[model samples]
Target chain A: NAGVTQTPKFRVLKTGQSMTLLCAQDMNHEYMYWYRQDPGMGLRLIHYSVGEGTTAKGEVPDGYNVSRLKKQNFLLGLESAAPSQTSVYFCASSSDSGKLLSYEQYFGPGTRLTVT
Target chain B: DQQVKQNSPSLSVQEGRISILNCDYTNSMFDYFLWYKKYPAEGPTFLISISSIKDKNEDGRFTVFLNKSAKHLSLHIVPSQPGDSAVYFCAASWGRSYKYIFGTGTRLKVLA
Candidate 1:
C-alpha cells in the first residue's frame, strides 16, 4: 500500500501564478499536515486538518490554503505564488488516537516548487 | 522567535564514535519531544521520542535525554556508523496534539 503520495513531484511557477499540491494517504489517518522546508530551516507547518471537512492554520500559513474534502486527500493551494514561496513541500499524516506523541508520522517524498 | 533551537548547524564524528546532537527549547509547556532523521531528497522519519515525565529513553543505539527544568533535550547515538549520517531534527509539542515545533536541523556526518 502507498503510505503517502504527493502529486507533481516538481513544478515551476512564475510570480502571481497559482497551483495546487495534492497529498493522498492510504492509511486512513485522521490528521494530515503540510510543511515547507528551506535551507537551514527545519520543516515549518503551513496548514493542517484533523479530519475531513476540517482545516486549521499553522505557524506559516500566510500564503497558503488547504482543503480536506476527503478523508484520504489533503490539498494545498497557492493563490498567488511569490518568489519566497519556492521551497520543498512535504505532506504528512498520523492517526488521531490522542497518542500522537508515540505514533510516528508518515511523510510523502515531497514536492519541489520553484517560484520565479 | 524560534521556540526550538539547535545551536550546532552540523556535526562530524568518526565511525564507531559517539555522536551527540543537542537541542534546546524556550517554551516550558512543551511536554513531548521527538527526533527525526532525514536523508538527502527524502522526508524526515521518526527515530525516537521521550515524554517530559521521563528523563531518558533508549532504543538500541539511539538514546533521547530530556531535561524539563532546563528546557533541553539531546539525542545520543552510540558507536556511530556511516549509515547513521543524516539531518537530525528535534521537535516538541505541548500536549497530544499534532502541533509540533521543530528546531533548525543539525546535519550529522559519520566519517568512515
Candidate 2:
C-alpha cells in the first residue's frame, strides 16, 4: 500500500500568495486530518474530516481551509499565505469504527511550507 | 492550554540500555494514550498504546505504562539500539473523538 502521500514536499510562498496542499491516501480510511507542526509546539490540528464532503475546525483552523471532496483525497488551502502560516504540514488518515479511540492514525511524509 | 506535556525535551542513553520517556496529561477524560516515533524527515509512526483501564501494555521491546492517579504515562524501550534514536510524541484522546492532543515531543538518542 502507498499509505498516505502529500504533494509539494517543499514550497516557498510570498505573502499574499495562495496555494493548496494535497493529501492522498490509499488505505481506504474513513477519517482524514490536517495538522501543522511548529518549532517548539507539537503538531496542532488545523482541520479534519470524518468522511468525504465533511470538514470541521480544529485547534488552529484560522488562515486555513480544507475540503474532502473525495474519500481518497484531502485538500488544504491557504487563501492568503502569511509568515505565521509557515510550518511543516502533515496529513493523516484513520479507519473509524464508531468506537471511541478505536483507530490509529497513519501520517504522510509531510509538506514543508515557508511563507516569507 | 497544553493538555499533554512532555517535560523533557531530549534524552541520551547508552546503547543496550533502557530509555524511558515520560508524558503527562491534564485531561482526565482521555481514555487512550499513544506513543509515536518520528525520524527527522519522516512522519511519525505508531509505536505503542495503552487503554485507560490497563496500567501497562507491552509489545516487543517497547512497553507503555499508565498511572491514572498521577495522570502520567511513560514509554520504556529496553536494550535500546541506535536505530531507536528518534523523536517521540505522546498523544491522548477520549471516546469516539478523532482529535488527539499531542505533546511537544521528546528526542531520544542512543549513544554507541
Candidate 3:
C-alpha cells in the first residue's frame, strides 16, 4: 500500500503563477495535512482536513488553499506563487487525531517547489 | 512566537555512545509531545511520543522524557548507530487540536 504519494516531485514557477500539488494515501486515513518545510524552520502546517470534504486553516495558511474532495486525496494550491513560497511541501495522513487514540502520521516523499 | 524550539542546531556523538537531543516549549497547554526523524530529501518519520501524564516512555533504544514543570522534553538514544544520524524534530499539540507545532530541528551525527 503506497502509504502516501505526492505528485510532481519538483516544480518551478515564476511569481504570480499558480499550481497545485496532489497527495494520495492508500491507508484510508481519516485525517490529512499539508505542511511546508523551510530552511532553519521545521514543518509548518498550512492546512488540514479532519475528514473527507472538511478542511481547516493551520499556522501558516496564508497564500495557500486546500481541498479534500475524496477520502484518499488532498490537494494544495498556490493561487499566486511568491518567492517566499519556495520550499519543500509535505503531505501526511493519520488514522486518528491524537485526541483519544494517538496515531503516528504517515508522510509522503515531499514536493520541492521553487518560486522565483 | 515559535512555541517550540530546539536550541541545539546540531550535535555529534561517537558510535556506541548515548546521544541526547533536547527540546523546549513555551506553551504549558501542550499535552502531547512527539519526535520525528528525517533524512535528506525525504519526509519526517515518527520516532517516539509521550503524553503529559507520563514523564517517560521507552521503545527499545529510544526514549522520551517530559518535564511538565520545566516545559522541556528530550529524546535519548542509547548505543547510537550511524544509521540513526539524521535531523530530529520535536512537536507539540494541545487539547483537541489537529495541528502540531514543530521545533526547528536538531541534526544528529553519529561518528564512527
Of the candidates shown, which would achieve the greatest lDDT relative to the real structure? 2
User: What is candidate 3's lDDT per residue for B1-112, written digit by digit as tens?
Assistant: 8999999999999999999999999999999899999999899999999999899999999999999999999999998999999999999988756678999999999999
Candidate 1 lDDT tens digits, A5-97: 999899999999999999999999999999999998899999999999999999999999999999999999999999999999999999855
Every model's DockQ, to 2 decimals? 0.63, 0.73, 0.65
For candidate 2, what is the DockQ?
0.73
DockQ-derived CAPRI band for the predicted complex in model 3: medium
List the candidates' TM-scores in order. Answer: 0.97, 0.98, 0.97
Ranking by lDDT: 2, 3, 1
lDDT of 1 by residue, B1-112 (tens): 9999999999999999999999999999898898999998888899998998799999999999998888899999999999999999999888667779899999999999
**How close is chain B to the truth by TM-score, in each candidate?**
0.98, 0.99, 0.99
Best by DockQ: 2
Q: Clashing residue pairs in candidate 2, if any?
A: A100-B96
What tens digits encode model 3's per-residue C-alpha lDDT throughout A6-92?
Answer: 998999999999999999999989989999999899999999999999999998999999999999999999999999999999999
Task: Indicate which candidate wins on TM-score.
Answer: 2
RMSD of each: 1.2, 1.0, 1.3
CA deviation > 4 Å runs, candidate 2: A97-100
In Å, candidate 3's interface RMSD is 1.6
The local distance difference test score of model 3 is: 0.94
